[model samples]
Target: MSKRKKHNLQWIKETLELKEDHNWKSQPGTRIFVAGRGALRFDVPQDWHFEPDTKSFRFLDKKPPNDDCRLEASFNLLPPGEWADFPLVHLLKQVVRDDERNPIEQGEIIRLKRQTARIVWTQFKFIDPQENREAYSRICIGLGSGVQCLITFDYWVDDAERLTPVWDTVMESLVLGLYIRDPRTGLAFPD
Candidate 1:
């Protein structure tokens, strides 16, 4: 058999890499997720596993692959100058739309901004006929440094009341950051 040559594509070369820090295990209260881009960092629980996309970090409350106890979060950095043109209402419309192009039952969109951070929280509820139970979720859009980051919490109606408190605690501890350049020095911040 002849040997085939190895080649790397531009996209493949720039793909993000996920790594678990040994230091996180040794430290008592510090947990961090570092993306290969050096521009993204997340303060995540030490036990959560990185998702395939590298943009999301997932933590399961019980055993593996159980949707009932999953928390999913992802970050997206918008292209330069795109934040100004980004419409929250438009994005929300798309997010809540189902396969039939219908909006799910949702509450009013609440918007808040603090310093450089702008956040939009949307509450949604729908009945999952297959599970014979209601489904609830909170979609959070946090904008900082022109980046829109999403943090979603989903659970069955049965566990909604019990998991409400749990989600609050987790959201409080979650931290997301994007690299910012020092205008004076024109240099990107170190990871």
Candidate 2:
């Protein structure tokens, strides 16, 4: 058999080379955190595993490939000079519609808008195919300046007593950055 070469795409190369400390990072605290890219300033439970990605990240509360206990966050940022053309609610609805499975129970959209940011979210219950058990999830989308962040938290219903607090902590502290840039130096800031 002949050996095949690995094809490295532009995005794959760029994403692979992104160092943790230089790009995204989590500062020490009671909960794990994702802080960078002007996308999020959010945290998860203290014991969860932190996994990184170019435009998204995941926090696993349990071992992978099975069971339902994890949180995922994805984001998009507009170019410095541009502003969002679609309303926040529009994006929020799309997220709900795009869920992998039809939910058994769905809560109303909870929305909060302020000068700093506007956030919309809801919780849903469904049967997770991989785990073959009832799963609870919350999807939150926030927009501010030219950045938008979407956070999804999924857990087993039986574990709500333990996981609910983790979800609350995340929503309470979620902060979307303005993504502003300094004229002299193009680096982002705030810890």
Candidate 3:
């Protein structure tokens, strides 16, 4: 593996505290692989189509009919105290309002559960688009005395029952990475 891949693998292992016997292999698709501590492993389908501009991972389930999901991850580089200017809760509320393409109903926000971690509490939504079809999104923002990080996870499911565990694990792993501090002078990851 190349240095980037090797570094990601090691980072995942150490961050997630994976055991030696844990299976860590690439999944089918564009080789868009993600492995964290424990048995957490997932990949987007190679054949599934998506646009690079969206910076998202798309997948299609072969066994089902028109079943799919798109997951997008991005880092927001804010100045030390900039994040606090816009509260995490307000940021999410504004995103839902600004993006009419995905309107989150008031009931969805009321149903969201707040989860507190070392420096983050997530507000999540799992709404059924129509009978038997579901879509979910979670926005997690971490706060330090002077630093904050935001991570979002979105998934569409034909059945809501299959959504909980996978979504939970993925979001948890992403939050775990927030504990690592960047010492660089750049606002975001150095290109």
Candidate 4:
């Protein structure tokens, strides 16, 4: 068999094995991300597909290579302190500062407070050079209950019509589920 890359785009689907992993478990419109001390819950449209990776949990509205319309969530298990201890804007500012991309726009910070739980939120739209197109992303950092959960979503301009509602659903539905215990072990996690 020839080792040539298909059409120079660098993928030969039918001739490739294509995986180290591909796993997902879904019910309706929700998915749970569990960490050592806590868990995060968010809305992932039931119609979308899930991709497994070692670094983070990835969900997409379409298949790979077409995965520009996607969401990425990272569970930060090692936060320095509890949410109430830090000045909200300061923490959020650090997050926005760490990004290397030049964002074209920024939105107001949304602080989601549930009793004592707090999740700081904001979004930015920028052009992703790797994607070679203008893309928008919503970033929310849930800072409370001794944990930090970051969720970022990116979608190309062309797919906004189909992807916007999915974004709204996620934004409204994302919540930090703190210390929900498992039935058997009784550790912190969702059932």
lDDT of each: 0.54, 0.68, 0.38, 0.63
Q: Which stretches of candidate 2 lie over 4 Å from their true place?
A: 1-29, 65-68, 80-85, 178-191
- lDDT string for model 4 (80-152, tens) is 5544766766777777777787888887888777644577777777888765677777777776555567777
Any runs in candidate 3 off by more than 4 Å, and if so which?
A: 1-67, 82-86, 102-104, 107-157, 176-191
Residue pairs with clashing backbones, model 4: none
Q: Write the per-residue lDDT of candidate 1 for residues 115-176, one digit (tens) a residue.
A: 45566767687666566566777777777664567777767768877777655554454333
Candidate with best TM-score = 2
Better of 2 and 3 by TM-score: 2
Per-residue accuracy of model 2 over 77-167 as CA lDDT, tens digit each: 6567644445766777777778777888988888876466788888999887755788888898888766678888888889899889888
Error of 1 at 39 (Å): 5.7
- Backbone steric clashes in candidate 1, count: 0
Model 3: per-residue lDDT, tens digit, 4-112? Answer: 1112221112324444554334333233333211111234445544322232222333322344544433333345444334455666567666643353433333212
Best by lDDT: 2
TM-scores of all candidate predictions against the true structure? 0.60, 0.70, 0.43, 0.68
Model 3: what TM-score? 0.43
Model 4 CA RMSD to the hidden true structure, in angstroms: 9.2
What TM-score does structure 4 among the candidates reach?
A: 0.68
> Which has the higher TM-score value, candidate number 2 or candidate number 4?
2
